[model samples]
Target chain A: MSATVDVAVIGATGAVGEALVQVLEERDFPLKTLHLLGVDEAVGHSVTFRGKNLRVRAADEFDFANVQVAFFVDEADVTRECLEAVRRGGCAVIDLSAGLPAGQAPIVVADVNPQVMASLKAPYWVSSPAAVSVALSCVLAAIAGQVEVTRASVTACLAVSSRDRQGVTELARQTAELLNARAMEPRLFDRQIAFNLLAQVEEPDNSGHGALERRIGNELKTLLTRPQLKVAVTCIQAPVFFGDSLNVSLQTEAAVDIPAVCAALDASPAIEYVEPGDYPTAVGDAVGQDVIYVGRVRGGIEDEREVNLWITSDNVRKGTAVNAVQLAELLIKDHLSKILT
Target chain B: MSATVDVAVIGATGAVGEALVQVLEERDFPLKTLHLLGVDEAVGHSVTFRGKNLRVRAADEFDFANVQVAFFVDEADVTRECLEAVRRGGCAVIDLSAGLPAGQAPIVVADVNPQVMASLKAPYWVSSPAAVSVALSCVLAAIAGQVEVTRASVTACLAVSSRDRQGVTELARQTAELLNARAMEPRLFDRQIAFNLLAQVEEPDNSGHGALERRIGNELKTLLTRPQLKVAVTCIQAPVFFGDSLNVSLQTEAAVDIPAVCAALDASPAIEYVEPGDYPTAVGDAVGQDVIYVGRVRGGIEDEREVNLWITSDNVRKGTAVNAVQLAELLIKDHLSKILT
Candidate 1:
């Protein structure tokens, strides 16, 4: 079969933006023509998609009139600009950036809540949860149905890619400089990222909760459809160049059986459960992985009411880009089924 | 009052061993003769103290008969051998190594447990807890006395210096190779420690808990004096060269006020509480600090019974060497007062 639909990739040069292009091609999504859009300077740069070199177009200059879907994978400000144009042209928007169309947009993780998402109206403005939240909510969605989770506490170690291309470049550059005994200046991040763990994100809003910390908590509630579930989220910048790891503790309403919880996690489509005798590490097992690789599953020593889990996932592929692409697939399938009938 | 005490620093060439020498000099501890001892090869190597170059002697061959105090800072095995010889000679052993006469040793964290330690016997074989446990317990000791702490969950990012001189050197070597796009192998650790987070410690005991993980829990329980306090500890080896950060959550027996807990923490001399508007990071705030830098204190959302704390400290100074030295200071105040009087 030939290509059937046309989609535009906004913010084509970002870490997640670049990953979106790859995920689309790797998943073999039905593409009539892939439109690559970015800033004015990147307009002439080319990205290879399906053996064809597609020249990037400035997002402001391009018309989104007939675009079937537009994936906005840039920073919040740039995404806000793209969202306005995409919405005006009645194009379906899959947002990976923090900027979603302000009001009542459903933050999504495709596998976690597909049925609820399918019921949304056309030209839907969809927001995807952050990487840490997606990985966490996927595992929780499996158990939230089986048991009532009263609270969750997560300490996440994010990869360098979360800052986009600049993040990855800065880590590589600063790391080399430090090893050579040269002084490194912090630019992309607030402090040194060469071989240090940053306790906070780039910006710390009032409550002492950094940007990444706040997002994880908010998104957890949104994805799990539980607005009141207490979540304590601490996002630290790990020195690793790829893969994110989260140490999560969940307190259920009642005592939970360890064996039953493991069985539920194994059944979840979005998570790959690591059985006993085998543990998962990001560099060894989770790099380039498509699922939330979960292991070290057990109950708390004194409190069986609590469940502890160590989860690792590829921050780029499964974190933002791939999830945006997955949501687009769901958007197409659900919308296409209606038009065809 | 010229120098009046004879002290020997075992494992003088290692990280903690080296730091122990520095702490002793900085504190202006009265010394008659400072004997630095390690293996045979390290014996002729000199370290400067108060403008004098003191040469190291072989630890095994050095006579412990006249040594008033000996600090064992090497690996458990080396310290184990030294403990036996030192005990026979009636020398007071302040052990930082795992080896220190394991059976009935009282593990001390100088500031946290001086009262309990003052009553111990002569020639006390006192062991210090790991850095992670020491930091966690310092804060918990404050809260546990005020509020009943049923459980504590900690996720600590450990520095390379926690291992020793070899660990610090290995990380530097590995980081350079990776940045230069060269192949690197794991030697001192079980896996890569340059820019990666290891899933567990070098050795994994049957319960699936790594060496560091098991030690943190055992030490926390011992320090808190609650033999049954349920502590969940996850120790991840970070790529950084110094400083350690821990994300700790405490489940109190009852709902507690956040401000009251902060007041208790502030009252604790060992902890420096960062009030609102300011936070702590490993590299920027904690690298060479003495106190357990605590900030980001908040109540758990939805679950009011849980308390969250973010703590960072110098792994070598506050974690091991400094704590060991403080124990010696305690020993002098407790025992020397009796002799002097």
Candidate 2:
């Protein structure tokens, strides 16, 4: 196995795409050729990866046969046929779209179920859950081994970047305009999200749960493999530009020892547990961090059977791009390199 | 009984104080001489009431004997001895501080237990819970009658104005500076609250629960008079300037009907229910409103005995100032009128 791997990154000019390019450089991804594909409008726009200025080309011209690995990062109109073509060409594709087709691929979080994901034998495509779910799945997996989680409830505060670059730019403009005592109109969200809290991140359905709220629950169930875990999530669009913050509470099958729970969490590789006094916050602790920052472990006043945790993670850096890179690394080492000659 | 009632508003120079002046004007409270008393720094400052301007006098120098009703708006250095002086002068006082003397008077939320509060015969000083507590307490009280709440958990996303005037101004300055790539220091809170979320609104203790968190529980237990009804609160300082948004979860003794719960909420005057798809948000629905905005009602999938709701209210207007004014109205009509000369 001596040939270098060729890679193509679709939607390469977007937020996750930008992060993927940086991660590729930082990790020195083993590649013979790196192709940056974007929309027709971004044809001449260039991105620097490993000190190489590569002009973006339209994805319509991309040849999947040459793409040993492809990253789908933007919410561009990707079709089943396009994905099938990439799959038929033996490309290891990682999707980070709003959602993926049911039973399409082994949906995964790298830290949670890496071994199973690594041993894939066929030309495959996998999908990463939303940023919030990716961060939360790690913590739940870490704790599930030590404590039997009977039920779970999560209140996720998503940052502006969860919507992408335009969301961030709009928040920047609106924040400035509002601070200057000028009225600012909402473009991406239904409410003024610059200096306010939008209670529902997506439209509410008949069940009174927003689309984003339902997605978090669905993805958590899929990742944890506990279909009846009693998951309830409320996604709030906060004003912050980065880091997904969550207030998570879980009811275990039995009473919990506070110190033991903290010890188990500290032992988890993907979790960074801060001491009580220095509580983990979105900007102060979690924005640039790779692992989920967790603190403020609390037990009930009289009953120790329940616990509350505060957690945060960089939604784009770690949640989407870094996880995608890790998954690709696992794929190449286990299966893709075997085909190289 | 026919003469207008004289009232003194002590510490009338804070955020709640500003809202107090406006609510009194809005409600057209029966008044004779509306005395505005402040600390020495605000001595010559004048506040308007019904097109009449009154200069602020030092609260320490004001005669309590002339006070028919007094509302404490600021969290200044209040003392038990000073409070005793007002009680000895036969004045009725309403304190808006954190901890009022136990057994001093009944701690009250106006809409929740108005009849009992109004019927108190003793000349007294009563305390009102914070705005977030005020909003949640009303909803809990309304539902407590229909179903027995075994336990409850709340995640309160408090607005910047929850801190005070400096908080609002700091957010204004920080929002502008952060947009321009300039860092602004935290002046009122423990962290940068503009475009960010502070995990803990108060200092942590042995339990890792912040002071605000503990206060919410302690106050709820006392208000509901159900010391065993488990309560846990996580207070997050959000960037919004006015509304307090909270995610509430409850475990009732029996299964809950979603529509019936919505109907019960709508039947309560203090709660304003928002239908699904039109979920109530902080800036869009709750800010400046008098009622607690409730939306997103959902029952647990596996266990119908549990329920979740999203609520918001103007922490200053209805949370603090409006409740104080309403308490005064009850005091004057049911208790003070019997003692009037």
Candidate 3:
């Protein structure tokens, strides 16, 4: 690993991509040059990074020859395409997508499974979990530690931003129109997103895996190494623009004493436990941070042996970009590049 | 049972009280005369019932004499005081508060366990479940059918209105202010209630049972007739103003079939299934309905035998006043008044 490396961030105009640029700069990652890639529509746009205006280039036209490490922040298809190009160009590709088509050892949250990337072969990819689930999984992994997670259920109060830039804009437009006594129609969401909540996120497949669910399940499996864990999720869309809040219940293999759980959570670097009577974690509280905020820990009813938790995190940060950047930092620290490629 | 009965509704200014008045009129329950009682501030205030302006009388000044039934909708202390007075007046009291002092049966949803009330030999006391839990428990009980509820977990998305009238006003005012670019402060909830979700409702007791949990557990035990059944609950405040939504997971004592559970739910008269892919029930959809709206039924993970469901009901309607009124109607039809007073 060099003191400074050439890095490329794909899907530069998207929400997570924008956060990726900011996170790299905020974390002071040593970068020789930063390449921003997006669709043709965003080609002429420029985002200021480290006091320099970096013009976005179309992913189809971008050259990956000199890019030592590339962060694929686009959709799964685009990411798959870019991974091939970057790998062929002899560059390490960190994919923040569902998974690298089977043979690739895709790195998950470096904190949870940093050792998985030690032998990074070709197409070095790191798949991040869905914004809502990753935060909880990361926090839980940090505190719970190797415990059998039997039953897990999550009810997500998702932000419109989960859809895309258009979703966020639609929320603002609908809210403004509704408040002004104007007729508001649903666009990004199935129903009104102004001062309301909708329960379904992605259309459920017969296999019970929506896009978000698949991502959550796959990423958690990669991070926690438990592929058979039982996870029931109900993702809801709230009127908020950014942070995602999840009410999660976990039935563990062993009894979870609340005090012990609290102590473990308090000691974790990636999680902050808000006291029971303190201001409970909400969307507003998590809008701009990188840490997963966990509070409101309680015992399960039928299984008093299990523990339930309420977790919230900036979906764009800890869920996506910040986590990707954190993985890059771990790779650099572990000096794994000497063994790969 | 008598063909005619005199009834008084205490705490007439609140959400539940308002719904109670509407329920009385909607059912036209053999009322010879109706009296509305409230605190000192609400005295002389008028509430319209069946097109007649009924002036609210002070709880202390309201006459309980000759009243066949008194519905106590105030705080526990207030309900306790009213019950003592009503009992002295030889009138039966259906107390909505937890202050009934333990000996009497806290009649949850009368439809689910009307037998609990039937076994009570005493006059002057009946109780109801908490608004949120009763809605889900009623649905579960209808399906479980005397099967032991081994474990039940509820993640409640409670409306601001659940906090009381002032909470409702605060939510509306703060939301408007937020939309108008005006700064707002938290009042009804521990945090901002406009565009965010707060994960804790009431302060959690040292035992992890908040006010919401205690009420739900008490209600479920009485309704299921399983005094020892365990219930774990996490109640959160959402942006919704009136309806309470719960994502519940439960394991029953019987081998549960998803199709059979769905059939039982469909057959239950007081519940309406909000089908999957249909607009998931929100607070606005349940503001004035009498039936508990349930949807998104799915099988549990690992234990394909367990079930998970999403339930939403107008907390003020089916959860409180409507259910109470429905009980009164059943009592009239069953001639349960032969044992009263």
Candidate 4:
């Protein structure tokens, strides 16, 4: 455990990838060296890590022979291409793309399901839930423990940063341009991400469940230890740059008292209860935050087993990068580094 | 019925009052002369009606003696003040303020409850539901019918204009000032209200229901012909200027199909079904419309007797003015005008 480990970060230079680098530095992960890989167009370019410039390598040219862990943040197809190579090279793979390993458990949040990583015998992949879903699961688990979650309906107010670095730049550029009396051409999103909210996502199947929804449902089941919990989600892109908010209404098996739920939430370390009287929680307050902010807890109605709450978090950190790094930290702490490496 | 009727509009110069005059003109109500009444500050201001300028008079000095129908658009206290005077003047009073008539039945959306107005005699008072509440009732009636509404959880995306004319002007002035590189001093709303939504409303009573919530509950009871239904509402203010959108989830005794509910909604003349494919119905599209837009109809869960839908409408029109005028039209059609005038 004292020896530093070689890490390969695929999809380096992307939003989540950049955040992963920052998180690795922030947490002071024992890194002997870091290998950055991106598309062929980004090859030979450099990304600064820990005050040193690391040249971006094409996925085809990446030397995974000595890499201990390969963090796959690339697209699903690209991750699929490099999965076998990294695994064959004896590097543990942590895949962040939507692709799931068949018949394998893709651990969701490291804090929620740390034991799931203990059973992995080789370089295995883990799937992170969507930003909103991660934020919601963190919030909901703190309140209604052991309760049957019959339904979960969320209105996701997503940020432009969820799209990637270029999307973040385009959102800021378009918003500033509009503010400076100039016209904007939207390219990152299907609609104008300047001052509007769009509700389209990776298309839903015939059952009206999109890829994000299915991922969230499967991930929540794995994380919460409930495999049959039903989840209905509506994801919408908001005009925010970072952080996403979910307006969640849960139908539990038993009636929940609002005060008791708030007390339980306040006691949880993963949640920071934003005072409901504060009026509204803005994206500015949520940016770069580790703790998910929970507010607006209220009872539903007489004889109805439902409660509503609003949860917000920084998608890049708690939703993706920090979560992945945290899982790696847990693995090291639990003496599973030998297996992972 | 063809004869000219003297009409007195209290709360003139206000948002709903302005829309009331426009609705009357648009519907060609049989008004020989129009008298506008407001507080002392708004007195002497002239508003044009039917291509003619009509001076606004003080509510205290306005001669309600000759007016056939007096519309009270002022606050609840002011409406209570002039209710006796208007009644003593032998005119039928239609109160739009939240003040419910002591013993008279309040009519909500004349098309839905025309008989409530038809039963009115001389000096009888009729009241309409709040804008958001009416929108909710309209949607619920079409979907649930006479089924016992076990519970209703509402999240209102209200507009600043719901407060008064000052709110309307403040939002516009602040938006323009922000666009013009000037600081915005918002007085009507508690917060910025430019690009954010706030959940600040009149504080809830001992039973945890605010004025808007209580009014919505009572109004729905009257309109849906169910007096025992329970409702839980959370009203929030959004950046929109005119329309209010509500995310409503209701539990009923019977199950409802999505298409059947859509058909029921389409069958109702007062509602317009915005298809699921066409969403994000902004305030601009719903400004002057008289119909409530209902869409996003989906099932709740596996065994839950509930459904969710998005409801939006022009607060000034379908929620208030147009509904009042429609009630008056119903009175004329029912030959009840002779009972008052």
What are the C-alpha RMSDs, in order, of all predicted structures? 2.7, 2.2, 2.6, 3.7
* Model 2: DockQ vs. true structure: 0.69
**Model 3: which docking level applies?**
acceptable
Candidate 2 CAPRI-style tier? medium
CA-lDDT, candidates in order: 0.80, 0.81, 0.74, 0.71
Per-candidate DockQ values are 0.54, 0.69, 0.49, 0.27
Q: Where does the lowest 10-residue lDDT sum fall in candidate 1 chain A?
A: A332-341
lDDT at residue B95 of model 4 (Cα atoms): 76
Residue pairs whose backbone atoms clash in candidate 4: none
- Model 4 chain A poorest 10 in a row by lDDT: A200-209
Residue A110 lDDT, candidate 2, scale 0-100: 92
Better of 3 and 4 by lDDT: 3
On lDDT, the stronger of 1 and 4 is 1
Candidate with top DockQ is 2
Rank all candidate structures by their TM-score, best first, as comma-separated numbers: 2, 3, 1, 4
Ranking by DockQ: 2, 1, 3, 4
User: Candidate 4: deviation at residue A17, Å?
Assistant: 3.1
lDDT of 2 by residue, A152-201 (tens): 77889998898889878878888878777887777877778776787777
- Residue-level lDDT of model 4, residues B237-319, one tens digit each, is 55556777677767677775667777888888888886565554544356689888886666554434666677778888888
In model 3 chain A, the worst 10-residue window by lDDT is A332-341
Cα lDDT tens digits for candidate 1, A156-208: 99888887777889998888787778878988887888878877665555545
Clashes of 1: 0
TM-scores of the first chain across all predictions? 0.95, 0.94, 0.92, 0.92
**Per-residue alpha-carbon lDDT of model 4 for A183-230, expressed as tens digits?**
677776755555444544545454334567566766676678776676
